[model samples]
Structure formats: C-alpha cells, structure tokens
Target: MIWRVATLSFLLTLSYLCFQPVKMEDGKEESMELGTQSQSQMDTSDSQNKGSNEVEEKNPSVEKSGEMKPDKTESDSGSKPTNNEKSANKTPEENMVEEKKSEKTVELKFPTTLEGFGYKFDEDGKLGDIETGEPFVFKVRSHDDSYNQKRYEALGEVITEYVYELLEKEANLKRVHIPVDASEGEAQSFIFMTEDALTNPDKLLLLIHGSGVVRAGQWARRLIINDNLKSGTQLPFIKRAVDSGYGVIVFNTNENRIRQGDKFIPVRESSTAVDHGLYVWEEFVSKSAARNIAIVAHSYGGVVTVELAIEKEAEFKERVFAIALTDSVHSLSHQEVSSSVIKLFKRIAKNWVSSKEPLDTPVPSRHRYECPQVSAGTNKHEETSWSSFESIFEMLDKAYKEVTEIDKEEL
Candidate 1:
C-alpha cells in the first residue's frame, strides 16, 4: 500500500510539471492554457480590426476572451476603394470646400492662421478650396460676356487695393518714399521698409514685384484676382524676412510713372522700373550700412536686378550677398551677361524656374551660364516664389554663414 501511494504521488508530480506554464522573465506564472487563450484573443482582435473604421465597436469574443472577426470589407483589400467608400471618408472641411467650389459666389474670409497653406483638402488627398478674402469668384453664367468681364475687372481692382492696404498695415513694415526723376513731376517711388531698416542694417532683403499692374508687396496681379492673398501678395515673404532678421524692401518698380499734369509723366520723384531700381540702390541700398544684401525678385524684376547689378557692379561685388529670382524673364541673350557678371551671378544668384522636378533640384538650363537655375518645385509660374521660399532662404542662410565664417577666418 505504501509503494502504491508513492507511485501515485510521483505520477501526479510529473503531470503537474508537464502542464506547468513556462516561467517568464518577469516571474509571472501564466498557465499554458491562459497564454494560448490570450494569443487567440489577440489574433481575433486584429482580424476584427481589419479595414474597419469603427473604433469603439467591441468584439463579442473580446468580452469573454478579447476578440472578434468579421467578413473582410472593401477597405481590407489593398486595392482602391469604391466611390461610395471615398464619399464615406470625406471630411467636414472637404465637403464644405466642394460645396463652395460649385457655387459661383462665396463669402470669403481673410486667413488668420499660418499653420497651413490655407487650402482645404479631403481625406483622399484631393484639394477642395482655397480661402481668399474675395467675396465672390466671378463667373459669367449669363450670355453678357462684356458685362461679365467688366464686373470681374472692377472686383479684382478692389481686392488688389485691399491687399496692398493690408500689407501697409503690417507692424514690421515701414513705408519709405523715394524720389522719382524730378522730370516725372511730383510722383513718388514707394518701397516697404521693415522696422530697424532705416538705419544701418547688417542684412537687407529687397523684394521686387513682377511687371505690369502689380505694385509693391505683390508677386502677381492675377494671384489676387484669380487666387487669394496667400498666392498673390508678398506678406508671407515680408513676414518671413522680418522674422529672419532682415530689413525688408518692397521695391515698387512698376509704380514709377503717374498722371499728375494731364500728360503721362514720370512722377516728380518717379522713374521707370529700370531707373527706379537703380535710383533706390544708389540712394537707399548702397547708402544703407547693410554689410550683406540679398534680393528676391520675380518675373520682369529680373531685368531690374541684372541692370542694377551691371550698372552698379562695384556696389554689387562689395555688398550684394545673394539673389533669388522666381520665373525671371531676364535671359542672358538680353545682355551677354559678361564673363565677370556671369561669374558674380554664379557665385550669388539662384534662378527659380518652373519645372516638373522637385524644388531646389537642379535642372538643365539654357541659361545656366547666367546663374544656377533649378526647379522651384512647382509647375505654376506664379507659385514658384512660395514653393521655393523655404528652400531658397535655406540656401541663402547657408551661403551667408559660409561668407561670415570665411570673414572670421581671415580676421
């Protein structure tokens, strides 16, 4: 009887050892059955979550052990979702944008945020609408084309004026009036000045608007007319320049000639773009104790820049640090861009051109001899400035640092 009891006890010990849970590193005693159950529950939870957008839905199996699974939905497959699924993913802002885009008229609200580009997009990566302060996007639904054109033109002018006024109101900007040719008769050349810029500035950034109806603090006239302030105006650039410790100069080259005495004459203080640019450099830029000068010019402003550089080669060589031009119309053919000028440009200028390649990516340029031409990372002619702003400024900062370092080393 003693031997039988011992055999029975030994058999019981072996059975307990065989069924014991493996000891975990944390000294937790989990039964093998419990671990198997937990794993089964996890697998079930994952299966239940497959392509299901419902987050709070609890699995029935999870209530007992933690999991559930259902038939694979359309979202489970790695293939494109159906139109109905796309509609289901639409965000509130995206829906609003779609509704707004379809309407010929919308109540526009001025943008108050700088976190984003102010573009509304859907969950599926579709651009919905843009926020521009214009009250309506003019469209001629009726047959009166002439009347429609007139209506839009007047509205566009109003918006342009409104944006310019807004720029004038920015705290960092100061309005500096330059005298045009005394021959232009009482006309004044205006450039926006940032705070602390009237005196000697260590860094000066010149902002030149494109040609035509555009004025100071503007990149393109149609950006305001067709798009919004974000696209049309240079406020973003101005804000950035000011933040980056640069004295901002919004060059109003196109606003040189005015009608003061009946006949169109250059304002008493005004000159044409070419002459006005030169005059500004001589009077304000050259005189400013700016140790380093950089220029950001768009469109025809390139002509003004190159002409100024060629005219004031000595000043340019001595002070101008970098030049960033967007969709510049100035070509080397216009002025052979002499070897000396080309060398200076190669050392300092970066021409932002509209190309399919990514921003700042170098592209083959017919005028590479003039300067470094690269993709502004956008195909839109007007958008080149904004798209390349961060990248271009980064380059400028790097170059500036190098120059400063070299100066320090020389000392």
Candidate 2:
C-alpha cells in the first residue's frame, strides 16, 4: 500500500511540471491571448504608417510562437527586392533627381592631383600628350565660390604648363627665361621664341596676350572651354608667323607668381603688368637681333606695348615698325605717355576693337589719345583676337612691304 501511494505522488508531480504554462522566450509569462493582441497592435501600427508619407511602413509577420516581428518581403525564391521595387512609391521628379545624383556620384568624380589629371613632366621638364583622355571642362559648382575659385586657379596653372608644352611641340618654339629682377633672386619671366629669333632674323613678330590668367601662348581659356583649341590658343598665329618668314616671340607677362616647392610666391619686381612689360622689353625684345619688329598686342597687352614705347622711345622708334592691337585697353593719358610717343604710336598702330560692325570696318575711337579703331568682326571681348587674325596678318604684310620700300629708298 505504501509503494502504490509513492508512485501516484511521483506521477502527479511529473504531470504538473510538464503541463504548467511554459514561460515565453521573452522571459514574460504572457498568455497566448496576449501574444495575439500584441500582433494585432503591430498590424494596426503598420497600417497607420502607410497613410503618412513621412512614416516608413514595416512588414510584420507572426512567428511560430505567435509573436510579431518586422520582416522583409521576399520572393518565393527568397531573392531580395530590386531597386525599382524599392523606389516604386517615389514621384517622377524625385526619381529623376535621385538618378542625377547617382550619375554625378559615379561619373563626375575628378582627381585632385596634376598627375592624376594625366599630365607629367619628363626628365627634360617637357609634358607629353594627355594619356587619360579626360576632357578639361573646368566645371565646378556655382554655389561654392571659394572652392571653385581655388579649383579654377589650380586648373589654370596646369593649363599654362600644358600650353607651354604645346608651344614647344606644335609651334617649334624655344623657351627663354629672362631675369626680371636680380634682387628677387632667380625671379624671372619666360618667353617662347623661334630658334632664329635672336640670330638676326629680317622680321620679328612679337605676340603679346592679354592680362589676367592668360600666359605666354593662350589667348582665352573661355574659348578653350566653350569653343575649340585652335581658336583659343596662339598656335595659329605662331604658324602664320612662321609661314610668313617672321621670327615669333611669345611673351609671358601674366606669370607673376613663381612656384617654390608646393607653394607660390609673388614675383614682386614683375608683379604688376606694366613692370613686367617694361622688364621684358628691356631685357628681351631690345636684345633680339631682328631688324624690323612688329607687335600684336591684345587687351592689357596693348597697354603694355604703350608703356614699352613710353619707356624706350628711342629703341621703339628705331625698331618697332607696326603695332596691331585687338581690343586694347591702352590709355595714353592714364599711362602718362609722352605726346611725341603718342603721335608715333598713332601713326604706326591700328586697333581691332570688339564691335558689331563688319570686319576691318573703321570704328570711332573710344579714347581721346588712341590708335585707329577697326571692327574685329565679333562683339565678344575674347573673340576679338581670333576674329581679327586674318586681317592682322594682312596689315603686317602691308606694313612690312611699306617699311622695306622706304628702307631701300634710303639706301
């Protein structure tokens, strides 16, 4: 009877342990009814979120244990959702903006270094063709002024170097660095010249570009960006000069900053446009052995030439035979040029000013003491040099013939 009683007690205890409500995995002793209520609340939350554009709706699924969990909707094959499926609710404008952002992120990424831009100087300090095949667009965000300015500055420096290389390769010109100031210690400005420029050529063509960011061989960077390189660079003029048997000298007037290590220092002596012009005229143009020198000055370059004439009147009168200007900003009164120099300049020089009139048509002079003004065939400031290119060569030819005829008569 005792054994029978013990067995019955053991059986009852085992049944109680096995059948008692098991604690949820969540450590809460919630009933099945409570779990069902929680799932119902999650479904209601999801439905409410779907109505608000600001709220993101989440997929809810009930686990085997009857607990609600956030779930991702997948295909029967268990594949992830496509980008199209994920962005299905986006508006057309939003989709277009997103696509543009994606494209900019991927395609518009640019390198921050010179070599990364596919330009490298060789052992001889000469750059070869760009290997990366990247177009130099100079495109920057308009909202960021300071950042874009710095970027444009860096790009301008690299473009100057590339143009220097082009002058050597395409135009068959040699680079000559003349010291502008001995006090500044190695402060010098370079110029491009033909091989026979200093070897006593009969006629010399001095090509002087405008002020600002333009260097020795560039007419306008804007044209390089918007138009073709042939219209933007001085190679066409150099080629024409060579074909006409004239030695070319391309002056580097705007290189007022020299690179030292990784930083740029101001070339104080040649810093100002007039100072650079004076120094180059004294050190380079006067030193050349060419007999008849003609100047093709553009914009501030015309001002430089005027200053040159004022400073070196004797040498100017003796050698400089003709001056062809394109949109010159020369001011005889502002520059304090002498009356005698002004009269001589007026006789020898002609300006191709930007105007809407026909090419080479006479335009009324804008300044009191100025050269004869003629239309450049274009109304744009930067387009003047290129548009007046053919007319300029013709003027040079006529001047050379007239000057040589006078010289022969004197002989």
Candidates in order, TM-scores: namely 0.64, 0.66
State each candidate's clash count. 13, 0
Across 155-244, the per-residue lDDT of candidate 1 in tens digits comes to 444545555667778545767776733333455657777766656457888888766556787775444544456666788888877778
Off by over 4 Å in 2: 1-152, 180-185, 261-263
Q: lDDT values of the candidates?
A: 0.61, 0.66
Model 1: ten consecutive residues of lowest lDDT: 41-50
Runs in model 1 with CA error above 4 Å?
1-135, 180-185, 261-263
Best by the lDDT measure: 2
